[model samples]
Target chain A: MNDSKFPPNTNRVAEHIVGLPKSGIRDFFELVNAMDDVISLGIGEPDFMTPWHIREASIYALENGHTSYTSNLGLLSLRKEICRYVKSNYAVEYDPVSECIVTVGVSEGLDLLLRAIINPGDEIIYHEPCYVSYAPGIQMAHGIPVVVPTYEKNDFALDPADLKKAITPKSKAILLNFPCNPTGATMPLDKLKEVAQIAIDNDILVIADEIYSELTYEGEHISIASLPGMRERTIFLHGFSKAYAMTGYRIAYACGPVDIIDAMMNIHQYSMLCAPINGQEAALEALRNGKTEMMRMKYEYRDRRNVITKRLNEMGLKCFKPVGAFYVFPNITSSGLSSNEFATRLLNEQNVAVVPGGAFGKCGEGFVRCAYAASIDNIVEAMDRIALFLKR
Target chain B: MKNNILRLLRKNARLSVENIAEQVSSDVATVQKIISELEDENVIRGYQAVIDESKLSELQVKAIIEVHIQPQRDGGFDNIARRLANFAEVNSLYLVSGGYDLQLEVQGESLQEVAGFVSSKLATIEGVTATATHFILKKYKEAGRLFEDGAEYERLKVSP
Candidate 1:
């Protein structure tokens, strides 16, 4: 008898491991991590810790023997809090019991949603220069990925005409991410309405990732799910990551139609019993009592964003002012260097690590994504180093 | 002078130095010198047939597709990228710099046909995460050819 417990050779394994060709952010982090006294501007996650109260709550939960798995949909209280949170903050209502499912993180929520909705050969519509996970997730689900390129002149906003052109009979869904990663651009209410109209007209489902809803600097973040007739068609993803600096907690939630939620939960149940019990407890505390902490972090991020934007522009880099999230995407094409070259050189020469724009997508070639989640001191030092590099 | 030479080349790539000089009303030496420089730089690699768009009514709709992807365990995006590159509808494939990972330039007869290619063909492939599609509204410029002459001047005049 063979004593080896070998994994099956399923073709599905090949399909699951997409998007490995280019992971510049991960590379940048590794490089930075390996360097001594490196001033890294590469990471997208917040530098702050989970709030004290939220941490305490998780500790309490663990101490009181709340370690077992909750419902497949997650703790009812957490789902209820998510419902209330979205409704109060963005005017979106979701049925706590039927419509919402707690996820390990927004990343996992995205994976589950794709697994639930995408069939082999289905097409998913998304904009270029978007978050990195969307395409690979679609591929893992055996779905086609379609990209609509957004122009930097438009601050990377989705254009309706462009969307209209991309639609085909094969399109099953669209993934919309606002307060977007890399760019930090947020869609206005009118734009959200337009996107909703497009989705309704085309009979397409939408997966709206609004994880950075609580971190908007210019105006309140709008939810596509809140639009008329959008609630049924939209799956809204949110989490305690950006707003509460709970990156390590890895807790997130998705709210959508009951059927979709159920499908996603089915996948979630088998794949990972539930989001970590501790993470769920911590997220609950975050939703309940971490509003002040959220605001404080948001303010800090906004301030840093402004500082970075001003400094980058002053140094002759063309940077669009990001109204949400904590990233500044500055066009470094004028430097006469490709994005990868600039990023690699910056990291190696100046000890400043920024993700090259090309790492995000082709449209990002001339740009560099510098996350401003670090402290002001780091930001200032990084900028100074960058200026020296540019001058040279 | 260069514009005239370019225009002549666009019409017929195989034109000789004397023939091009005659067409553009320039001396043979000047035209031949410019042609040599363009060739030396490899910008004018070699000219091929310029197919008439109207002749190929079979290819109608043109689109730019943005694809997001994740890495697979063993194969990664290489296999998927190669698969997409192999599609007949794909004119160009670019590994992009922004939100989406891959950019594909594709063509079809109708929007539905392109959609079919996406759904029935591209999406079904393993390792694809998400996709967004943008259709070409107007060809303002392509392959260094101006779509609408004087449009830029008109806009500039209207602005002030």
Candidate 2:
């Protein structure tokens, strides 16, 4: 029995696992890694280390032996802080005891939310060219992903008309990532209001992944859950990764109607158990004291964005100036090559690493996403090399 | 506007007016005009590159001298402080208010030169009384810049 399979078909893994493509940006980055003097604008994280005070808090917690898994709903103090944070900033309220569960990251929160709500063949309508995990999470939960394509001309904002068209009686939820990764598109109040209205009309549950909420540049982040009639129907997800430079800590939370959160906590209790208590302590410190550092990093990113925008446009790359996250989606159609070919060639020739837009989704083909979260000097140098590549 | 511009220039003097304007959310012409006004008013003083002399292959020694002097009939330590400030060897001089009447930071090519300056020039000044010279052993931080050098850190290559 161990030596011989009945046939290859008998030994095959599940069809869904076989069908799903590998998750994001791995191959191109592998080519980047085995190189000398490479400059990567590839990562979607803050270049700065986690702020000192937050790290210090985690260290203090660990020194006091707080290494155990927290309660499935997380430490009450952390949940309380999450409530105060969302209330003060977005005016969205969730009871610490009933309506919030701290998970591994926004990554894990996505998984828990999808698993909690989706039934077999339930449709999840989400925008294309989103963070790499959006579609995969829905698909893994046995939910069919319905793509709504957002264009650069629309500043990557989802059209409500398209949303209405995508919704059906089978549509179970709408997944959104704003100040979104890869695209860096933020929904303004007017546009966000329309999206919220569409969700209400369909009675669709909304999974708002707002991890990058604090990094918003131009204005305060406006949460759809904070909009009229949206609170009860939304599962608000956020994490300490982007804003607090705590990606390594891997703790985030999902807050919503108690029923949905209860379902999520059910899964959380079995599988993930709880987010790390040390990370929760660090995230709590960030919520309490990391504001000034966030502002400083925001200014750095904005400046780097300006430098990249100017330099890329100078080299004939059409960059959509993004006002939210640290990424810039530059149309590399001028290079007369697909974004994949462009990224491969640039990495090979100039030793500069950037993610091809196609890695995000098919709609992202002609563009390349450059994360300006790198140092200004490296950005300048990468631009110089890219300019040289463009010329050649 | 003026104070904001000064604050920015203080942090990074090499920043262009356009960069400062964007940071402060003002326009280029306004930032340029404000900077020009600051220059005229001497609020924006000179700019100098911070250099680590030890890294330049030059052997240098520094000494901080605390000199007590009886006040002149008219001028306090200001006269001697100004005199000490003019010396080419002096890096900085302050009319300090604590136990030390005056503080002088002096740099030289060797300890002998620094010792000679103190014994020959500083000791002969009229009304000069007690003197305590503290030789600096190492430079850790100077002018808000760190001097300790190490390997350039490379971040881990993979992240989402």
Candidate 3:
């Protein structure tokens, strides 16, 4: 049944889509899944279930006949709740009607934002050793991703100079994910002001992906848009996934200037149409009443962070204590093996799976991203296994 | 600082000092010292697990007895309260202000033991006037844990 008339490459995939590199992490996800006893310290989702109250609300919404696409901008009530939440917490205001659009997740929100704004070859500057989505997301939007590899010595804080160097006439926006993912770094207000000033001076847009805003351990996470003169140019990507432990709900939103959101919503209506109606209801419940459960989970993460950070350091892995997020990126240079080599051996020998830092970005070698979201007993046991592996 | 540690310990007595110190953001030594001082000062009276007796085959009976008592010239209800607390069967005693002067939570190996404790011991107190004992049929929630009508937490052992 071979169609011999057409050549193998007669019809080609889109150049941009074909050029997107396959994620190295997915291979490890599969490899770990095949093994019987492997401990997955590799996943980035929360170990906690979505709170009972949020689940109940979503169930009620379904029973009450909300099983349809919401408005293009999502339910008005949900947008209002999001606006109130940001205004109270970050002290930044947005007109919910004009400035907010509920997207499938930050995953979709980033895609929509990029397609809305980026012309061919428009450059987006982002911090490196970052979330795996940044580069591919930008590529899918037909934008060139300019990566600035932050140093571990600086605790992975974006150096204003490095960010400035990456900017040019072609640079359209700065994409930032603070309280960062793989590195577990957070940008304090002072550091954020420096970047904000640079963005203001350059007249470039700011794309702040503050999805982990609520999980900061030491101090409040400053939304870069909150700084003066920055609000007008900043597009905020935030959601209920990390904070409310609602990752599976696929609920997230974007808030920016009226013009930009309108542009994004134009694409959203044609593609995603609208976020799930029940997810919007659950998100509303999370914003209004999920504070206690959020704090409870945050408390658990903090304990895990402390134990893992201290244990890794004590074991001579030289981990920079992560003040935010649930991951601990520890330098494994002393092991004398490449990050992939170490991760593979650790899995094959000790049955503990950690994502190699190399999976994140080129500059991320000599380390591994160990998510501390597991129970304390597992974390302790994994650390013991790692220590034994190192010894062997 | 000490109060925060005590509060956390109240929620989970199984919490290690290392865990409590991490949450409160104090050094391990400082937390250890504070906890020891609290223990020496008798601020933390004791800790016990809240178990679901129904889950166990070795069943027990629980009863709450309300006692009306005349006030002593010296100790008021405190006198009867302390005397009631000394009994082996009394799990908890509170000087209540409603129709009763004292409320007792009593637990024993069987229904007969609880009944005997109420009739033979608790009623013999000099100031005791009348008694009403109520048997507990079930417990919905205790000390922040839900026994029934609660979802099991089935989070993946580890997730991203």
Candidate 4:
């Protein structure tokens, strides 16, 4: 049905929903899905399967007639495990009873937190190139998204100075994703300390999406909440998606001060009610016994990271070696094409698909994110094809 | 580092030295030296493909034979095990505890040939007290690969 038949003012859709821009990634994805024999280096999730034991736990849960809805705050046992995990990994403490609530995934957790906290027109400061969801998520929650550009010169690390400059009196929270997506950048601890101090000084809350923390290849991923004077003001979001290779399970959790967590849970109970019980059971198994497989996959990603980064640089893509995450954000400026142009031509000519960095934000205009989650052979072949594409 | 190299090779032995070096995060020279050292020390005995002989047109037979042997005064079962290991038909040999003294995986062109080996050669050996052979009927999985289900990447071609 062509919409041109309708009068100009006859539309009945919500103004905000209609005004929202379509996702750039979605447009590129349609083109990719229509093609055949494309080697994708664009997906953000893990290539590994969910470990058998975790899958078996969910199977067991289903077989034992555990199909009912869990508590509004999620299963008590799963929440307790999540708390313990947070305590050990982030060196922060929280009461499992009041301060934790399981959501569908980090995606839902972020949405819940934003809707719970954001007053209309409140500003959320985030760094870019970033995950594509942050700006739109904030906008959907009726908050304004303020972006600070992180450059390749600094290895895409968020500069606290710029972050400080972006904050305003209307700023409600700072959304931080260390070991970030689209850039594969992690904030330095000292910089994190500075950012935490700035937030404390301004009395702003922090919404930390640390979904990729476990895949850190460097020393360790430092949670901003762990810093002094930050725990009471930070919302920590993590999930079984990236680290556990359980993206399809849709199990993640949020932990914060009782008041904020209660607010998020209020929204959660009204809408999602609770995360799926089977996914929670699977996540419980993952938290308990999934370390070995998790580490194996992490090591594999690290290996692929090394090979791909080296190959990209050798082929004149000028990639920065990301210290964590399974992606290499290679600068494609040498090819004299915009990120989208390069991605389109490479896909059409060589059947190697990569996400244009511009999909993340404007700061990502000249580069493309090449996920190293693929097999080494595929990554090597993709690099070769990309090289050939550049040559031609 | 050695273990890491071996792990990559275990998955795919055909990787070039440069590929191995990149995967292991080492230079080619260092990887080359380490691989040569491993070869010299016999840590890497050989590289062979994992094959399912059942796929071939020619019919093949395989059997796991349990051998109960009497131990010599000084040599124990080592003398008999060494003698059995030299046979070309013996694919694998292990000295297992329990009812059986030694277990052997023997392969042949046919069931008759394998049965003949057990009767004429294995049973005739000194201190070979008893033998029981179990024939393998089919191959489902070999060397960490499934014959029926190959892993296909079912995820979307591109995502954010």
The structural similarity of chain B in model 1 to the true chain B, as TM-score, is 0.62
Once fitted onto the true fold, the runs of candidate 4 whose alpha carbons sit more than 4 angstroms away are A1-11, B97-99, B150-154
Write model 1 residue lDDT over A284-368, tens digit each, in one string: 8888889888887876676567668877997999888888888889999888999888988987889888888776677878988
lDDT of each: 0.82, 0.86, 0.88, 0.92
Docking class of 2: acceptable
- Candidate 1 stretches with Cα past 4 Å from truth are A1-29, B1-160
Residue ranges of candidate 2 with Cα displaced over 4 Å? A1-12, A23-25, B1-37, B53-57, B63-136, B142-144, B149-154
DockQ of each: 0.01, 0.33, 0.35, 0.85
- Predicted candidate 2 versus true structure: per-residue lDDT over A1-392, tens digit per residue: 35564555663777776567786577677777767777889888888889889999999998999888778899999999999998898898889999999999988989999999999999999997888888888888888999998888888888888888999999999998898788889887888899999988889999999988887777788998999999999999998888888888998999999999999999989998888889999999998899998877777777677778877887899876787888888899999999989999998899898889988889999998899889877888899999999988
Residue-level lDDT of model 4, residues B1-160, one tens digit each, is 8988998988898999999999888999999999999999999999899887876899889999999999999899999999999999999999998999999999999999999999999999999999999999987887777778666765688888
- Candidate 3 residue-wise lDDT, A1-392, digit = tens: 35787566654668888789888767666677777767778878887779999999999999999898789999999999999999998889999999999999999999999999999999999998988889999999999999999888988888888998898999999999888889998886778899999999989999999998899988777898889998899999999999898998999999999999999999999998999999999999999899999998998888778778887887889878887888889999999999999999999999998989988899889989999877777787898899999998
DockQ for candidate 4, C-alpha atoms? 0.85
**Fnat of each candidate:** 0.00, 0.30, 0.39, 0.89
| Model 2: colliding residue pairs | none
Ranking by lDDT: 4, 3, 2, 1
CA lDDT, candidate 1, residue B140? 67
**For every model shown, what is its TM-score relative to the native structure?**
0.68, 0.86, 0.90, 0.96
Per TM-score, the best of the predicted structures is: 4
